[model samples]
Target chain A: AQSVSQHNHHVILSEAASLELGCNYSYGGTVNLFWYVQYPGQHLQLLLKYFSGDPLVKGIKGFEAEFIKSKFSFNLRKPSVQWSDTAEYFCAVMDAAGNKLTFGGGTRVLVKP
Target chain B: EAGVAQSPRYKIIEKRQSVAFWCNPISGHATLYWYQQILGQGPKLLIQFQNNGVVDDSQLPKDRFSAERLKGVDSTLKIQPAKLEDSAVYLCASSLDSYTIYFGEGSWLTVV
Candidate 1:
């Protein structure tokens, strides 16, 4: 079974502060990774995804993630965040064949204005 | 296009009661999924359907849970004699292909 591990459970930062959330998966084969965000009372929305190709992938809302195969890590980063970025983030991974998706516990990010 | 649609945005039922949730996947989508998300945790797959046939239901508690997709379009998930632990959100998602799944606003369930 594949599992995703997110290091931070909660993070608080001021507006304009940079943010980074660590995500690691336990899959040994070709995998597809994704970052989804859920604002308060809102449905989950896609942030970005890494299927194949370059190691770095950029997503909406100025967010980006680096896929390091050696470490099995796909850490999400945002150089500057806004108050609107306050939401819970989830990291999910699925096998290349597009099987079941495994999600991490999730990281709640609160950006103070 | 209209995204996935779900009904009964919220429901509160007593223990041992039965509840059902309905979902309509995006048009032309061949895959539908039902996920259960407990508070403070990510969504977990309960059942998956390819068209009108089921693809996976391994995580579904068959003893109390049941789901179906009719005509390869809309889907319904039901829980009979619900338990307090079943208090969570039920999310419906769909995809044209197995990957790139799109989600809908979940239906919240509270068992007291």
Candidate 2:
């Protein structure tokens, strides 16, 4: 069975501080990776995704994720954080041949303005 | 385009009661998914349908949970005799050609 792990459970940062959320997955075969965000009282939305080619993927709202296959990691990062960035983030993975996603324990971020 | 649509934004029921949720996917999307999200955890995949055909449902609790997409457009998920642990947000999502899934405002269930 495939599983995802998010090392950070909760993170608090002041505005303009850098941000990084660790994500690791357990899978032996080809996989598709994704990062999703859920704002307070809002549905989950895609932040970024990695299917093939180019390990670094940029997404909406100044978010980016890098897929490092050798390390079995796809970490989300932002150069500077804003108060609007406060939300819960989740990392997900699925086998290349499958459509179902396996998500990790989410990380809740609180950005203080 | 319209994102996924779900009805009954919230539901409250006692243990051993029955509850159901409905979802309508985006137009032209072939894949629809149902997920259960606990208060502080990530969403867990419960079932997936590809145009009225089940693509995956390995994680669904079959003994009490049932779901169907009859016409490949709208879907329904039902829980018979729900448990306290079953209290969670039921999320409905859809994707075109199995890529870039979009989620709807979830149906929140509280099993007392």
Candidate 3:
């Protein structure tokens, strides 16, 4: 069974702190990676995605993720966090030929202003 | 471009009651998906449809749950005699292609 794992369950950081949420997938074959964020009372939205491209992919809202094939990881990162950045982040992966996504348990980030 | 739309932002029903959720995918999107998202967990794919045909439904609980995407544009998912564990957000998503999927504001269901 293919799965995605997010190492941190809850992360608390002060405003302006750097953020990194670890995400690893179990599949070894070609995969499409994605990071989605759900803010309080908002629907889930795409933060970034990685396909066949440069390992580093940048997305909206100052978010970025790196797809490291060797580690089977696609970790999301943000240099400076704001209180508005507090949200639950989910990492997801899908096989190259599949339309279904396997998502990891989400990481809840709280940024204290 | 309008995004995927879902009905009944929230619903509360007793165990054994029945409920249904409706979704309308983006115009011209061929792929539609239904996912169940429990609190503190990621969204789990329940079913997928390509146009009006079922592409994958391996995760759907066909015994008590059923879904249909009629006309390849709108869809409905229903649960009969809902269980307590059925309390979760039912998310509807659609994609033009396999890579760029978009999610709707999910229909939240609480079975007490």
Q: Please state every model's RMSD to the true fold in angstroms.
A: 0.8, 0.8, 0.9
Please provide, for model 2 over A1-113, each residue's C-alpha lDDT reduced to its tens digit, 9 standing for 90 to 100.
88999999999999999999999999878999999999999999999999999999999999999998889999999999999999999999988976779899999999999
Clashing pairs in 1: none
lDDT of 2 by residue, B2-106 (tens): 889998899999999999999999998889999999988999999999999999999999999999999899999999989999999999999886868999999
For each candidate, give its TM-score against the true structure. Answer: 0.98, 0.98, 0.98
Candidate with better DockQ, 2 vs 3: 3
Worst 10 residues of 3 chain B by lDDT: B94-103
Per-candidate iRMS values, in order, are: 0.8, 1.1, 1.0
- The alpha-carbon deviation from the true structure for residue B25 of candidate 2, after best TM-score superposition, in angstroms, is 0.4
- Runs of candidate 2 with Cα error greater than 4 angstroms are none
Worst 10 residues of 3 chain A by lDDT: A93-102
Error of 2 at B4 (Å): 0.6
Q: Candidates' DockQ values?
A: 0.82, 0.80, 0.81
Residue B112 error, candidate 2, Å:
0.8
Query: lDDT scores for all predictions?
Result: 0.95, 0.95, 0.94
Clashing pairs in 2: none
